[model samples]
Target: MSVMQGDGRLKSQRFRQAREGDWKRLERLMDKAEKGSARRLSDEEILAIPVLYRSTLSALSVARETSLDRALIGYLETLCARAYFFVYGSRSTLMGKLGAFFRRDWPMAVRALWRETFASGLLMLGGAIAAAVLVGQEPDWFYAFVPAEMASGRDPAASTETLRATLAGEDTSAGLSAFATFLFTHNARIAILAFALGFALCIPTGLLVLYNGATLGAFVTLFASRGLGVEVGGWLLIHGVTELFAVILAGAGGLRIGWAIAFPGDRDRLDAAADAGRTAATVIAGVVVMLFVAGLLEGFGRQLIESTPIRYAVAGTSALIWGLYFYGPRRRPAHV
Candidate 1:
C-alpha cells in the first residue's frame, strides 16, 4: 500500500509537470479575459478557450480517479466550473428567456403530450355527452348531476322567462370583483387538485375532469328544456372557452405524470416522473394564467354583454388565438 501510494504520487506530479505549460497559458489568457472583457481576447485566444477546456476536463477526470493531491484537484475543479458557465450556460436576459419559453418550449411540450391530451379530451367529452343525453331523456337526472350551489337557481324548474332573466338582470349576480376572485379561487383549487392527485395513477384526475364536464352538460340540458339553449350557450361560451381549455390542459398534465410513472420504459420510475413533471408543470402554470383571463371575462364581459352574437364573437376569437398559439406552424426549433 505504501509503494502504491508513492507510485500514484509520482504519476500525479509527472502529469502536472508535463501539462503545466498549457495550464499556465490557459490561466494567463483567462485572467486577462476576466480582468476586462472576454471580447477583448483575440479570435485566436477565443478559439483556444474550448480546446483548453476539453484538456482541462480530461485532467479533472484523471485527477478524480487517481486521487491526486487535494490542492491540484481543487484548482482543476474551480477552473472547469468557470469555463463551463461560458461554454454551456444560457446568456439570455430573463425576459428573453420568458418570451422564448411561451413561444417555443411550452408549445413543443404540449405537442409532445398529444396522446395524453387526446385521452383527457375524450374522457371529458364522453362525460359531457353521457350526461346531456341522460338528462335530455329524463329531466330528473339534472338534479343528480349538478350541485345546487353551482346551479344558482338555474335548473330544470326555471321557466323560459326566469332563465332569460339571468341575461337581463344586471345587478342580481355578485359584484364583478368579488365574482372574479371567487371564480379564480374555486377553479384554481380544482385545477391544482386534478394535477396533484395524478400520482394515484390518474383515477382522481379522471373523476375530477369527468365531473367538470357533467356540470356543464347538466346546465345546458336544463336550459335547453326551457327553450333558452342559445342564450345560455352564449352566456357560458364567453368565459368557458378559456376556462374549460385551461381545465383540460390541467387534466392533461396529470395524465402525463401518471403515464410516465406507469410506463417508464428505459428510465427508472423517479427519473421518468421528474422529466414529465417539468414539462407538465409548465403547462399547468400557463393554465393558471388562462383561468385569470377567464375570471375577468366571466365577471366583467359575460355579465355586461347580453348580445348573443357579440358573445359568440368573443368566445370564437379567444379559441382562434389559443389554437394558433398552441397548434400553428412554428419555426424550426434551435438546440437548447
Candidate 2:
C-alpha cells in the first residue's frame, strides 16, 4: 500500500509539472480580463486564452480521474469557470448595454408581452366600467374606489365649480412640484407591487390592476356627472395615458411570471419562471422610465398648459410616440 501511494504521488507531481506553465499563463490572462484590462491584452494573448482554457479543462478532467491532489483539482476548477465566463459572457460597456436595452431589449420584451398587456388592459377596463356604473348610480361608491387621500375633496360631494377649478389648474394650493413628486411616487409604488406580487399565480397582480382602474373610473364619473367630462378628460389624459400605460405594462410583467409558474408547458416550473422573469425585468425597467416622463408631464405640462385642446394634443402626441416605439416595425439584422 505504501509503494502504491508513492507511485500515485510521483505520477501526480509529473502531471502537474507538465501543465503548470499553461495554468499559470491562463491565470494571468484571467486576472487581466477580470480587472477590465481585457482591452489592453495583446492580440496573441487574446488568441491564447481559449487554447489555455481547453488545456486546463483537460487537466482538470485528468486530475479527477487519476485522483490527484484535491487542492490542484480545485484550482483548475476555479480557473476553468472564470475562463468560461470571460469567453462567453457579455462584453459590452455601460453605455453599450444601455443602448442595447432601449434600442432592442426593452422593445422586444414589450412586444413579447402583447398578450399579457391586452389581458391586463381588459381587466382594468372591466374594473373601470364596473366602478363607473356603481358611482353613477350612487355617489357613495366613489368613496370605495377612490381613497380620500387620492380624491382630495374632488368627490361627488364637491361642487361642480370646485372640480372644474381643480382640472383647469385654478386650484394652486398644492405646489406643482410636490404634486408631481407625489404622483410619481404613488404610481411607481403601484407598478412595483403589481410586479412583485405576480408570483402568487397572478391573483394579487390582477386585483391591484383592477383596483387602479376602479380608482380612475370613480374619479371620471364624479367629474363627468358634474358636467366637466371634457375638461376632466383633458386633465387626466395629459399624464394618464403614459401613467396608465406604465401600470398596464407592469401588470403584464407580473402576469408573465404567474402564468409561467402556473403553466410551465414542457419545461420545469422554475426554469419557465426564470425565462419569464428575464423578459419581465426588462419590461419593468422601461416602465420606470415611462413613469418618470409621466410625472414630468403631470407636474409641468398639466399645470402650465391649462387649455383643454392643447392638453389633448399633447396626450395624442405622447400616445402616438409610445405606440410607434413599442410596436413599430424593424429591419432584421444582416447576417454576418
Candidate 3:
C-alpha cells in the first residue's frame, strides 16, 4: 500500500510538471485579459490562448480521473474555468457593448419593425379620428374618453378662457423637475405595459394604444371646440412627437410578439415569439430613451417656449431627427 501511494504521488507530480509551463502561460494571458490589457499581447500570445486553454482542460480531466492531490486538482479546475471564459466569452468591454447597441442593434431593430410600426400608428390614428368625430358631435363623449384626473378641468365644460389659460402655462402646481419626473414615470409605465401585454394575442396592447390616442383626441376636440386647437396642437406636439412615437414603437414591439404567436409558420410558437422578442427588446430599450427625452422636452421646453410657431418648429425638428436616425441608410456591420 505504501509503495502504491508513492507511485501515485510520483505520477501526479510528473503530470503537473509536464504541463506547468503551459498552465503558467495561460494564467499570464488570463491576467492580462482580465486587466483589460489583452491588446498588449502579441499575435502569437493571443493565438496561443485557445491552445493553452484546451491543454489546461485536458489536464483538469486527467487530474479528476487520477484523483490527484486536492489542491492540485482545485488549481487546475480554477485555471480551466477562467480560461474557458477568457477564450470563449464576450470580448467587448462595457463601453464597447454600449456603442454597439446604439450604433447597430437599436436602429437595426427599429428598422425591422417597420411593418408593425405602421400598423400601430394606423391604430392610434384610427382611434384618434374616431374619438374626435364622436366628441365633435357630442361633447359628452369627452367624459368617456378622457379620464377626469387627466382632464384636470381642461374638459369641454371648462370655459374657453380657462382652457386657453391651461395651454398658456398658467398651471404651475408642480415644479418643472417634479412634473418631468412624473411624466417620465407615467409614460414609461404605459410603454412598458404595452410591451408586456403583447403576448396576450396583442388585444390588450391594441386596446391600450387605442385608448391613449382616444384620450389625446378627446383633449384636442375639447380645445378645438373652444378655438384653442392651434394652441393645444403646439402645446402637445412639442413633446408629443417623441412621446407618441415611443408609444407607437412600444405597441409595435408587443404586436410583433403577438403576430409571431398567432402565425408561427413553420417555427414553434414559443420559438417564433422568442425570435421576435429579441428585436422587440432592443426597440423597447430605445423607446425608454425616447421617453426620457420627451419628458425633458415636455417638462422644460414646453413650459419655457410659449410660441406656437416655435413649438411646431421644435416638433418638426424632433420628427426629422428621429426619421433620419431610424430610417437613414448606413453600412451594415459585418457581425450583425
As for candidate 2, its clashing pairs are none
Best prediction by TM-score: 3
Model 3's alpha-carbon lDDT is 0.92
lDDT tens digits, residues 140-245, model 3? 9999998887787988778888888787652463777888888899999999999999999999999999998998898899998888889999999999999999
List where candidate 2 sits over 4 angstroms from the true fold.
Answer: 1-36, 42-45, 51-85, 170-174, 333-336
- Root-mean-square deviation of each candidate, in angstroms? 4.9, 3.9, 3.0
TM-score of 2: 0.79
Q: In each prediction, how many residue pairs overlap at the backbone (N, C-alpha, C within less than 3 A)?
A: 0, 0, 0
Q: Point out the higher-scoring one by TM-score: 1 or 3.
A: 3
Candidate 2's residue-wise lDDT over 1-336, tens digit each? Answer: 999989989998899899899999999999998898999999999999999999999999999998988988999999999999887888888999999899989999999999999999998998999999999999999999998899988988888888888886635635878988998999999999999899999999999999999999989999999888899999999999999999999999999999999999999999999999999999999999999999989987898889999999999999999999999898776789
lDDT digits (tens) for residues 188-304 of candidate 1: 888898888778788899988998888888888888777788988999999999998888888999999988888889999999999989989988878888899999898888988
Worst 10 residues of 2 by lDDT: 167-176
